[model samples]
Target: MPCDACATAAGDPTGAEFLTTKSRLLRLLAPLLAAALVAACSTRAPLPAAPPAATPAPAPAPTGPLTGQPAPNKSRWVPVAWSELPGFDADALHEAWNAWLRSCERPAPAFVPLCGDVRRLSIASGEEQRAWMVERLQPYRVESLEGTSDGLLTGYFEPFLEAARQPGNGFDVPLYRPPADLTTRRPWYTRQQIDTLPEARAQLAGRAIAWVRDPVAALVLHIQGSGRLAVREADGSTRLVRVAFAGTNDQPYKSVGRWLLDQGLVRDATWPGISAWTQANPQRVQEMLWANPRYVFFREEPLDALDAAFGPRGAQGVPLTPGRSIAVDRLSIPYGTPVWLASSGPTAQLSRLVLAQDTGSAIVGAVRADYFTGWGEQAGDVAGRLKQNLRLWALWPK
Candidate 1:
């Protein structure tokens, strides 16, 4: 979600101290704390059931040549022929080429001269384009400084949700735009402070862009950094808008998914697992959200059929291509560089060319990558379940 003016860095925060989860006692004492709290629990409806995990694509057999051996440095270039790239010949190169075009929109200087070549080959046959790539780029395998060639690959996507133009009925939680005085305060406010403190609430009071019924809806939007909102306009028509990353409160971004894992409440720390835990522990939803101190702010973007076809702009300032765009550690793979990704995850065996078009909070390490799984529920299922072994090859200027 680090796009245009938004730059998000990863942070690991210790979980907040948990108080008792005794709902019966809390309900009895609720009247005394009425000013600061609502009833501990009510009959809350569940969110839509998460889509089933995608069936893993069969692993393609490796027929390509291997590097002579691992590079000695944390990341080293091993001379690899184009034949060494698994599934290289089979991919829809035109699709990847589209991602490459977006990469060139704010391309690194090293790639500027090659932009024209990319455009010219956009209409070429896949093989011709593959040939063009082999002629122009050198492929180097990436690894850790320790010489470990393997790393992790996960997925992320743009989520869509129902929202309201005004807060009422069950849609009471607000999604806010950045406050005008945001810059004046350092580490402006924690999630708990924002929810409970008067001054902290005052800063964001008038900046809501939309509202949702469940706090988790807003939380997921915050985590994803961007999402499509189906807004119920005052006149009863629905208009879709995107909430792209605006800025953050400068506090550390924490993972509630990870928090759920450490508490042993869930075995797999995926979106579905998080949802299941939230469903069972509705009374503690506020505490679960407050586990992360960092908060996100967003601004609206147009979401037409065309815009919805692509994803939010990445760090490269271009809309991301699903399955062909990746967020990498720029120090290891410069922006706009093409990469040969070989991964065998729970959902698929992915071996293809991807553009280093973005970066993310959790995407660290030279070999680490977050695969853009695209938009919507099915993509989300793949993204949630995908944490697999990954190897990378940077296709750079020869």
Candidate 2:
């Protein structure tokens, strides 16, 4: 006999009709089969019963916030009340509005709808903006899968260096653009190889965009990945341009600071410490620089009055807002996400909003971040010394 529930579930509507037909046929054959039924049952064996239906497995529980959204590939987002976010109410939202507005220029898919509200609130008061955030966003305490919340926070900045259009007059350290055959060469050339090898030199022969006087400063530019250059053109007039990261030689970034530490040459590996050592041992500067095999190429960009206000474009493809832009691991927290950062260390105490507008090779893990401190010497000073503990909260759409 057909199972009515199973038949209906399978979308076959003839189960009930088949049952009625079987009843009529049974009534018609009842008298004729009465005597033979007992004999037939005694002679024949019973048919095997149908196998039981398999049960479906249950779905896995959500690993993200209550909203049921999945966490980023490298981190989990545990939903928390806004009140739990330390100093959320105390932070001046207007200061971070510029970074939020910049994020709108290339908003992520999840944040696309919120950009309009973000723009409107740009002119609003801090208290009003805070209130708006409370209503529109959900705060998630960022953590690793192992439930670790504390992470390292470092800083980076744009350097300002003087350069020459041509290599002469003591401006001999060349910064190059990506070579024409850059793609053809896998892990093209190490920093030491590029400096000493003729074949490597030939590949980058005419690719120098500008040349600076100090090799140390050029190394700084390479590590920072970008900088502002006051370039002296062939006409002797100076023009300010930005050198942005183009490509690398595909070598690993072995830290010169780590090299110094491992060699027991210095206890401090900050830029200031490195500079002091380089000045003392000028002859060994090349040896110190070659400690790191990686090399970065750059492309020159025009720095107009409007562009001067912002830092060089970050990994997110947007101009970074100093003090308000942070580089995070894209696998942990995506670009363009607004974050509430809180840290208290020897260098500085920070409790404010920042946008995840950039990324760095070293800025990995669930809660790690590199804070952008803007440009020039002072900014560089802050960036060099900023290594501290950090905690982060991601403010996502409700």
The most accurate candidate by TM-score is 2
Instruction: Name the regions of candidate 1 deviating beyond 4 angstroms.
Output: 3-74
TM for every model, in the order presented, reads 0.81, 0.82
Cα error of candidate 1 at position 155, Å: 0.6
How many backbone clashes does every candidate have?
3, 0
lDDT of model 2 at position 368:
86
lDDT of 2 by residue, 1-398 (tens): 00110111111111111011124433543454344234223212211222221332122233444332456889878776666666666676787898899999999888888899999988999878987887777778899989999987777767777789998898899999998888998989899999999999998999999998888777777777888777788997667789988888888766677787789987766555776777788888899889878788988998866677677887778988778898888889988899988777876777778999988766778988887776665566666667778889898887
Each model's lDDT comes to 0.68, 0.72
lDDT of 1: 0.68
Clashing pairs in 2: none
TM-score of 2: 0.82
